[model samples]
Target: GDDDHEGEFGASSGGAFHEGEVAFDEVAQEADDDRDTISLVVVGHVDAGKSTLNGHLLYALGYVDQKVMHRNERDSKVMGKASFAFAWLMDGNSDERERGVTIDVGVNTFATEHRRIQLLDAPGHKDFVPNMISGAAQADAAVLVIDGSTGEFESGFHAGGQTIEHTVLVRSLGVQQLIVAVNKMDNVGYSQERFDEIKKEVGAFVKRAGYRAEDVSFVPVSGFKGENLLERKEEALNKWYCGPTLVELIDRLHPPVRAVDQSMRMVVGDVFKTQGLGLCVAGKLDAGAVRVGDSLVCRPGDVEAVVRSVDKHGKRRRHARAGDSVTLALNGDREELDNVRVGNVLCCPRNPIPMVCSFLAQILTFDIAVPLTIGFQGVMYWQSVNEPVVLNRLLCLVDKQSGEISRKRPRAIGSSSTAIVQVTCQRAVCLERFADYKQLGRFTLREGGSSVAA
Candidate 1:
């Protein structure tokens, strides 16, 4: 439910609404010149130490204090899970803490020497893969944490495991940079052989998933022992692995090019109400810039709202640009604002994002039980939106090496094939062509609880 409002937000009866109509090109670069901001998603199989690793990183970076750490330890011990103290820092929900598994996306912020990272901690279990896809959609890079203990790595890397699925999903969502963190090395006695074995296997898979060799790096870490995260102190670990620590590796990552000068478009991730700020929405800016007092429209409902305030990483700011994860307090009609939900896009009124029920997409199919033909049905995942969709037409199949059309109007396309397909959604979706907007255009198709294509 939303509150009742009378007039347009930030608008006067005199018809003067020019407060937020400034030229963005002149000031987009100067807005956040202090450092580059990167939205990073942490993903891996269940119990792979994704949360624990990031929890330790936060403590090491001084984001969590001693008092908070002691409280978490006391509470976790009372719950009979003393080992989850660090993980409890990120998994705050009671359901997640009680079950000892992450059920939703855990978000936090930290900074390196030259970059600010907005961390999106995704759930590892199969039931929450939808939440993981939403988190990955907003990220510029990802770190796939793999358990390094003897049989654990094999189980997670083998067929029907979340490791390969997570790897493929992130790459498909346009996450070009990757870091395969080999976690729990201490359980293997900090063995270099074990670390190398994981690196070799994961390296091959990432390559097959379309990640370049230079864009991918491997690091051995002990999330529980807090080794090689911020600093390497163990003699056993330092014996053979002399590469950069996890923090150092993150510091070296290159920020992706953004579309700050383009039209404003931000995909909503979550919506909630604050004590004083009536209705607030959090999301990542896909392109252009947003500022307080700017009038914007939310698609799928044509809800108009004004940016009452802007907060980036919990700090209020006047302006924010593309690649920045922010929460905005929007002022508008209570009934209209109530329609604002996750997967909706907020953009400039001059050019609202296109909302369509169908679009042409180029998808790379994975191993499927049957060939994909016209009327094939599945859920299409785009950003934070997932809708029931059906394949309308099988346009053609393209040859991988030659990038030329191999067949026209094929009867069906099977696994390991590339094809131009027409897809129709159950409802209207805000999107652009892949050539126009990569973040808005790319999507994943999941059928029967498994990712089928992307």
Candidate 2:
């Protein structure tokens, strides 16, 4: 059961609403200039060391103290995977450890002198691409970890590679800064030729995926050995590489500008219940601010909940703003939790997300086995929600290269195609025009266990 108040949170733990509101406003405003938090998501192909790299980073930053590492080492050794000790830091699930693959998103936080990074470790296997997108959508920048081991890079970077899919997906989701970590260099004796070759191949594809070459950086690293992550190695170690370490490149990236002034809107990335706090929703505040006692609406259902409390980066806060990954505790009708799930929107009571049965979206097809035609059925993944949708009409065919309209009404869109179409989901969804909100606007269509369009 929920508390009696319909829209107002009963009382602040800090006492009077006046004092809480004043402190909340100050905290939200300070974030605008502080730039203290930067959300970074790691993406790449499977076996590319994404977990090990992030785990090593957590170690170098002192987040994984020696005692923790020792325990991880003892546990991994007992399981006959002593080498997996570093990776154990992020792959916390037992199933993931047994399969030796990341099955879910791993999230942790680390700090540097300039800013704090909300590190998101996405599973690299194509099977987990949906989970990867969930992680990517909430990121400010990304690091594509490439395998430097022999023949491994080719398989992950060539046609039909996770590299292409990952790069396209992240860019489509609005991540501009990309740091390509050419990891596992020690396996090839740290050869400069190998690093250059991998960099050149990756850079060409990244540029085609809509990222400027200037915004992308490449550095040689060995996550397994803890090289070039936090500090630069000596010439004797990585002789040909004289550039900054992984942390240096990350610290140099400025956090993206936030939509702090827009009406408060946050997509519920996860949901849970607490003993005394009632319902809690965690997500990035896509725009504006939320205080301790604001009224909010959950739609697609138009349910109501009062902001019970706010938390950011594991710290209890009086307020949260755009770009900050926050969790909101809500007290309202208990049944409201039934309608709210991952991918639901929580927004200002008066300006809730518009739920629509159908909408027109300009789409770029990646590699579909067949042409997308009317009445086609597939899953629509957006803002952490994966719901079924049907293509109702092919409004127009677009130029393959230029993206301009080439035909008024094409019958279908094929592999490597572009078109604008009317998409009608099986259920109503909170959606907006792509041009209006890039974060919430883009999505992917998957069918037959493969991504057909993004």
Please report, in order, the local distance difference test score of every candidate based on alpha carbons.
0.86, 0.82
Candidate 1 backbone collisions, by pair: none
Question: Would you estimate the TM-scores of all the predictions?
Answer: 0.92, 0.90
Q: Candidate 2: which stretches are off by over 4 Å?
A: 1-33, 234-237, 400-403
Instruction: Output the number of the TM-score-best candidate.
Output: 1
Candidate 1 per-residue C-alpha lDDT over 1-454 given as tens digits, one digit per residue, 9 for 90 to 100:
0111122122111112345432221223324447799989999999999999999999999999899999999999999999999999999989999999999999999999999998999999999999999999999899999999989998888967799999989988888899999999999999999998889988988888889899999999999989999999999988898999999989988888787666788998889998777799999988878887788999988999888777886677777887888998888899999999998998888878998888888888887888888988999888878899999999999888788999999999899789999999878888887666677878999988988888
What is the overall TM-score of model 2 with all chains considered together?
0.90
Which candidate number has the best lDDT?
Answer: 1
Model 1 residue 242 CA deviation in Å: 1.3
Candidate 2 residue-wise lDDT, 337-436, digit = tens = 7678888888887666778889998888876779899999999888678889999999998886676789988878898777889999877888866655
Candidate 1: regions farther than 4 A off? 1-33
At residue 144, what lDDT does model 1 achieve?
A: 95
Cα deviation at 220, candidate 2, in Å, is 0.6
